[model samples]
Target: MEKKQFLYMLKLVPELLDEKNWTERETAIIGEHFCALEKLIEEDKLIMAGRTQNKDDTTFGIAILQVDTEEEARYLMENDPAVAKKVMTAELFPYKVALYNPRFTI
Candidate 1:
């Protein structure tokens, strides 16, 4: 099955987790998101996701998400625990993407 693709940009705030005194709860929260997000990806609902790895680890300086539509973007963003608890804030906008196949070169 072929699915539509849409690009979205999301920014995160470090909150207390990125602090020097971070707690296990914070780690668990992030881990939970990772697991949930992976499930979405495996199902092909999530096309792509990227985040910045800053030295300070102040959360993703900026993150990008690829979904199907603006509505889907909004729903996914809202569902993210990062946004649910102010750990991150999502600034979403629909965008177009181009895919390339580098496998067949002649």
Candidate 2:
């Protein structure tokens, strides 16, 4: 219940690989981590997460997450598959989430 939010910038490699080159094993491992993260969100351990289509070319995606503390947040980042494979980089920045803004049509 310590409510801390962060902006996660996930940087993907520039060299785009074919489906075969991507490797199923690596993809599966990353998928597994994502699945676990989804569960944590559902349980309120993670308030929310957001990522978008690959537009930045090098950036795989970006996300926003609300977790209990800075330690837990860093733990998640350190253990990410992207880091394990060294195919992507994650940089986290502390942010104050702007919620319930009537102007944005939320």
lDDT tens digits, residues 1-106, model 1?
A: 3345555444546555347645676677777777767877776667557676664545453334555566776787778776675656677665545665779553
Give the top-scoring candidate (lDDT): 2
Model 2 Cα lDDT, one tens digit per residue, 1-106: 5689876677656553334456776687668668866776786655555566545554355556677787777777766676656766788788776775557531
Q: What is the lDDT of candidate 2?
A: 0.67
- Native-to-model Cα distance after best TM-score fit, residue 60 in candidate 2, in Å: 3.5
Which 10-residue window in model 2 sums to the lowest lDDT? 12-21
lDDT, model 1, position 4: 51
TM-score of 1: 0.68
Model 1 lDDT vs. the true structure?
0.62
lDDT of every predicted structure (CA atoms): 0.62, 0.67
